[model samples]
Target: MRWPLTDAARVVAEARVRQGWSRVRAAWFPILQAAVAGSIAFAVGHSLLGHPYPFFAPVSAWIALGFTSDRPLRRVAELSVGVALGVGLGDLVVHVIGTGWWQVAVVLFASAVIARFIDRGAMLTTQAGVQAIVIVGLPALGASGGPLGRWTDALVGGAVALAVAVLTPSDPRRRTRAMARVGVEELAGVLRTLARGLAAGRPSDVEDALVRGRASQPTFDEWLDTATGARDLARVSPAARRHRDELTALVQAAVLSDRAMRNARVLTRRALPLLDPGPTEHDLHAVGATVVDIAAATDDLADSLATGRTPDRARARLVAAAQRLDPFVLAPDDWQVQSLVLLQRSLVVDLLEIAGVSPRDAREVLPPI
Candidate 1:
């Protein structure tokens, strides 16, 4: 009871805090880059370029650098082109039609429609409408110094943001590792909970384990997104090109982790009936022991990933645990026992593949039905 109410709550809290910290750390460089790029754009436009209002400049920079790991040149080009199209069309319409509520609506529609024809990006089209509204609503801003300063501001802002992206120090691998760590740790925690449930033959414990496994999906999603971003960054970033192998491995690990999580959910679902008090006490204990071994193997694999070592020992333990489950494998005569064994076998296969086993080879190592 104490373990369920106190220990479980504490573990969940700690995992969440750790995940939140990792996210903030991964985002630090991008946040800093955006701030610096925005300030530079504003200073150049307002103080140096002598424009009375350079609001669009910083806005463009922020839009260009919403996230730092994205393709810098592509984002810069998109933002600059979008801003120019909106401002230019808005200026033309408002200058002729005169400043009125209807004119603003007309310019926005025209800019959005024009941007859509030029590009398929939602960002581009959205910026087009927003910039149109700004230009139409503020006539003096469009007339400010620097001669079509708003249009030029967009170009300058984008260029500065691109420069910052190119020059800023970043490590996509760090983000990749952070994401993988969370994913693997979550899987390990689920295994540990399942181990406890099987040992106690407590339905409540299995229910807790199932809830935990189901709750882990968002963490797995974060892993996929982060690893994919890292892989993409490695493709275009010169400094990060050297880490392509590591990033790719992380991406694959994220995929494997997804399969493992889904399998775990199924395992949890199947395990519910197995926890009902039954006559096979000896076999239940054996299965519980094997599950704990698998949990240890899971933890070791996670540690190996963090340290960049081959998880040879953990891999061996995982395979051995599957074999160990053989004696405890009750026949389908007892559906609950058979279902739990089969699902456990599938989970082992996923864990093995994640540890570098081929699918065919991993399944061959499973206990006979």
Candidate 2:
């Protein structure tokens, strides 16, 4: 019992460590940008603006920027407005009513109401209320300029954060492409797993494939989200506008891949029952070989998407595979095997569309029934 418990503990610990490392790798760049933005905001407020204690400057900058490249320009503008509104309201309340519990409530209410009136963004209202509360709670001492010194510091911070966000050189499509590759590769892995199961006539392997395909929803969702964000950024950022078409393509690909994965899961589920009764006389080997070919083509798609290259090779491979998906040629008598082939045809068509082939052309690539 002790050994089993210890092993489980070790496994959980390793998994958590891997998750932490992955997060670090994904967020290190955004974290570094936030750090630099905060430092710059503090320097501008304390040195140039002559604010002795402009702590809100860095706080405002960090809050505005957060830690993701997915922020749209409008979001940044909203955050800046929220911070400024909150600071201004907090300053007024502190001077007029004095800092107390009641003052905090009043400032929060005022900030929230004013922010909501200005914009409908939830972050704007939430940040306004939070900043107002902080300002009310903390005493404003050692101020150099005037009663509005902290308010000016907050403005400087927001401006610096906005400047940093705009001036940062970033390819909006990079993260989208990365996520696409991840989603496509996972889809390919499911196909490969299904192939292995079919080749071996193993119900357990098919079951595993179905489970994996189901668990892959989050990856596809993330890919879609990333592509959408890239498209939004392209629309707003002049530097990224040129990549809008490509980002749109990626978004479409993400959608098609998601459909392909769903079909694969269904195919795997259908194949599981046939294997449960043990191997039959059906030509599952041929079916398995076709799945393997599709998996190879999926790998090609992943490579093309990751490198932003034309998926010519992947398209050709999928077309060739599609031509071979004739149910009559592969399984003339077995309806079950033929059904699997039919599902594969739909999945291949989706992959072909993802590779830039139109739906009509993709369907034409398949042989007539």
Candidate 3:
């Protein structure tokens, strides 16, 4: 009873600590990005063009728009184009129609509509509309510097933003590598939980494994996306590219292994309702032990992927243990033996493939489990 209460308290405490850390770290990323953008905009606009408005305005707009989403380039381009069109249209309209509510309404509406059409171009509409207002809404004490000034400013700001984005770009390869490490660690965690469930012969353990397997899918998808993006960026180092590919394959293999494990869990759960006449303690322990070994091997494979280091020793040990659990050789009637074999085979195939060995060659080296 005390143990359960203590465990609950500890979980709560850990959750709070994690929450606090996340909040603290969250600010660092956005602020650092914003500052970098602002500095670049200022330097380019103020020093080179002698016009700070061009740099600051576009950069500020990018930051305000939250360019950190999945598509930073698209967002920046959209907003910059929107502003440019809006400013250009507004200037053109003011020249044609004298300042009035109707003129303002017309320019805003026209700019918004054109902006919408310009790029996929939802923001273009807003961009043009706002620019129209800026050009004609305010009264001028002195002669207008004209549309040229506004256009120049918008162009400068956009150019600065684009330059910053292209120059100090975030490498997708690095992101993939980071995710691989986390994914592998998570794989290890999942395997441990799964092994425990199988060992206890509980339907709940199998169900939990299924749930974890589903949850893990996003990690693989995200890694794939990052890898594809990084490969496209072509800015990653040669070592990074190779490593990224290896990690990608490793994750793909993990997904397959997870699926196999899931199927085995389902079988185990189904067997739970069926009556087992009698089983020797030794037989039961063997089932549990085999499941744990399978998990350990899978975890080792995941670790290798995360760290770029192969688990040669663990792989060998797993191969040896899997052979011992062979249904054809060891325990013929044990259904658990069949399930364990499936997991073992799936993981071995994936691991070997990730190591760049051919499937036939891997089979030659790996004995049937």
Candidate 4:
């Protein structure tokens, strides 16, 4: 017999290749960012003569600058104020106490305390405390002149960072679009998985789906962020607007499907006692298998959406599976039947809506709703 080791190794190698590609791309971003920051610092320092604190200002300004015009101006303002306050506090502590280990202790403690007191930007105040320590510790800079020079430098750096951010704004719109795509993919996965469990009508499969869904919540959050950001990008084109709406609707539909699947699973578990005679068990198992097939189709549809194609077959099968589950109403377990019917109907309607079909069309597609 041929060994399976080679096949397993191939699978592992492919996974590593994908992961390495992602990491390599990510690595380039920080390198580019550092280069830009360094260039600004050097240019600003060289341009201004009497400004004396050129290097500090450019760096500070760059730090203060945000990626887009959309970033809150308030944040830059907060950053500037925080730096100023920290530098001032550090200078004050150094001048009053003089230099020693105790002075260092005072600076750190005061920085931490001031940082905490600032409430919103604790990092700012602590930075100020550290600046004070530098002022006191470095004899070459001296106690008097050095503190002022450092503060001026800090101001210059903030200004440079801010100016760069404002002048060469990066568009966040593409990032938002990418995020929306991720959300759409996740919604599809959950729906497909649940659809599979429904078709199988097996409680164990349904339970497994629940675990998968919980793990997807972070992806849901990421998608939600993308949707919100896309909306904020203020795109005026009809196509862009429509895409945003579709993403929003997709998230809603996923939520509805999740709820419906959970309710249906609970109903099935409760109805297990009533599965009864061998013939009913056989029929139920058959129905469950159909549900599983439907789920597989849904997963395919999700894959289609990611690839920019319509999943018409999956859509049709989902509606058909809902109809097949309808006869469960005739079962002896009245409560279970009612619950399962409710959940099944909800999922069918949501899935249809995602396929751009109206609720009425979905119900008509059902088998005698």
Q: Best-fitting candidate, measured by TM-score?
A: 2
lDDT of 2: 0.85
Q: Quote the lDDT for 67 in model 3.
A: 32
For each candidate in the order shown, give its overall lDDT on alpha carbons.
0.75, 0.85, 0.55, 0.52
| Candidate 1 local lDDT, residue 72 | 42
lDDT of 4 by residue, 177-243 (tens): 3433444444444444444554555444444444444444554464455445546433453434546
Ranking by lDDT: 2, 1, 3, 4
Clashing pairs in 1: none
Candidate 4 Cα misplacement greater than 4 A, ranges: 1-145, 156-160, 163-176, 191-206, 229-325, 328-342, 352-368
C-alpha TM-scores of all predictions: 0.78, 0.84, 0.60, 0.51
- Cα distance off (Å), candidate 4, residue 7: 23
Number of the top lDDT candidate? 2
Instruction: Flag regions of model 2 displaced more than 4 Å.
Output: 1-26, 40-54, 71-74, 99-105, 112-122, 137-149, 277-282
* lDDT: the better of candidates 1 and 4: 1
Question: What is candidate 2's lDDT per residue for 216-306, written digit by digit as tens?
Answer: 6777887898898889778878878999999999999999999999999999988887876745666699999999999999999999999
lDDT per residue (tens digit) for residues 1-369 in model 1: 123566457656666776677678767768777888899998998898888777777878888787544444555667777876777776676667877899988888888888889888787888888888877888554466544677777767877877876676556676667667778888888878877887877767676776677667778888888788878877987777898887787788889988987888787777776656667542355556767888889888887766667779879998898775553344434555656677778888888887888899888887665
Model 1 segments more than 4 A misplaced: 1-19, 99-122, 137-147, 169-174, 200-204, 226-251, 276-283, 303-313, 327-335
